[model samples]
Target: MTLPASAPAIVVEGVRKSFKDTDVLRGVDFDVPRGSIFALLGSNGAGKTTLVRILSTLLAADGGKAAVEGFDVGAQPHKVREVISLTGQFAAVDEILTGRENLVLVARLRHLEHPQQAADQLLGRFGLTDAGARKVATYSGGMRRRLDIAMSLVGEPRVIFLDEPTTGLDPEARLEVWDIVRNLASQGTTVLLTTQYLDEAENLADRIAILHGVRIIANGTLAELKRLLPPATVEYVEKQPSLEDIFLTLVGHGESVKDRS
Candidate 1:
């Protein structure tokens, strides 16, 4: 089926999934605008990953419809797979392979021309040029995550699913991944991010949807969600830098601190 250029990159309507007796998602619906970052915010066990799996064609939904790049995820899974990529909570990299090798492997699998060149370009694009030759086992968490994301981009997929992309990273590493995510959207890749971090959704999403009770409890831009709260009473207080702010500042500015990555 042909879709207009203005159609959303992803569409989920009444999508439902159940694990035996447990209902994970119930009548979930959302639209992800092309070239935008859409975050699925929820606590653990909220079925965020389940929803991603269905949308990415990794798992079949029990009911409802989902499409990626205008292809039905259930009916045209192969076509959906052609235009989408999935990166799970953990960094999926081969420990024995060098970062460059990993990227090259994915490029070759995608049948891209000059796999080596593709890998090198991605290494540089993701700031992994210096670590490209090192075994992934030797990579820091952030580097591994970067390489994982780079692999996902091998085919220039129109939609990318990132499930808890920063689950096990330090603050610095999280910031690194955040920048990469922002860059992805800037380059017109539709990103569906499933994260439990409120600040993460606030920091990255163009629109955020809160999933709870097997349903989407809230959906809107951050500003719109914030408006749901009672009007703020005017107050005066000295603003203090957050611990994250201080850590980033000091760690970035301090010359003698050991590398924590």
Candidate 2:
């Protein structure tokens, strides 16, 4: 298939990785479009985390080439780091510091001229303005997660790698994080997310790749992926609604639905 004119935010060709004797990624190839959300779905030990680490420049691939924002991940690590941000499954906030302080620290680390101003703006944007003065230890899980994501934005990265960002968040908190991600995409940021929750991938990802056995078994939009399976009718009781209906009610509309029927 022909790709768009815009440069890919991420590009991987024949990427491979191994730990000791076990191979993690086996000649993986994919391209994530700029200013779009790409979901990488995989079971535990399917090498999703390894792929994220390699893209983030935290780990080097054993073979092949990978690039982020047109900069080679292995050759131009500094340039890749400058344009990308990575948020792991767990929040990494300083418990001793206030939310505002955490953002300020990140801003300073990124060499922002006005760290305090940038911190305040991010705090307000993430709905933590009122609790900015409280220590991170006093913040709830959701709050800390928000703070972690806010910290990643301190450098205004063009590409973000989110590995199960809402893993431990409550339903409400997950929605909040989803909104934040949507807003970032709307602002022209490229997001590459690894998620276990199929619903989360369906909700946020413009494209989804299902990784199994160290390779991508499926790659497409949700409808396209679903279409790969044999067609079947979903039976439901007239009076009793199904889980799918409930999900549709709770999560609102899915973009894939329109394309399916």
Instruction: Give the Cα lDDT of each candidate.
Output: 0.86, 0.85
TM-score of the candidate numbered 1? 0.89
Off by over 4 Å in 1: 235-261
Distance from true location, Cα of 107 in model 1, Å: 1.1
In model 2, pairs of residues that clash are none
- Per-candidate TM equals 0.89, 0.88
Question: The CA-based lDDT of model 1 is what?
Answer: 0.86
List runs of model 2 lying over 4 Å from the truth: 1-5, 234-261
Clashes of each: 0, 0
How many backbone collisions does model 2 have?
A: 0
Which tens-of-lDDT digit does each residue in 32-138 have in candidate 2?
A: 98899999987677799999999999999999999988889999999889999999999999999999999999999999999999999999999999999999999
- Top-TM-score candidate index: 1
Error of 2 at 43 (Å): 1.1
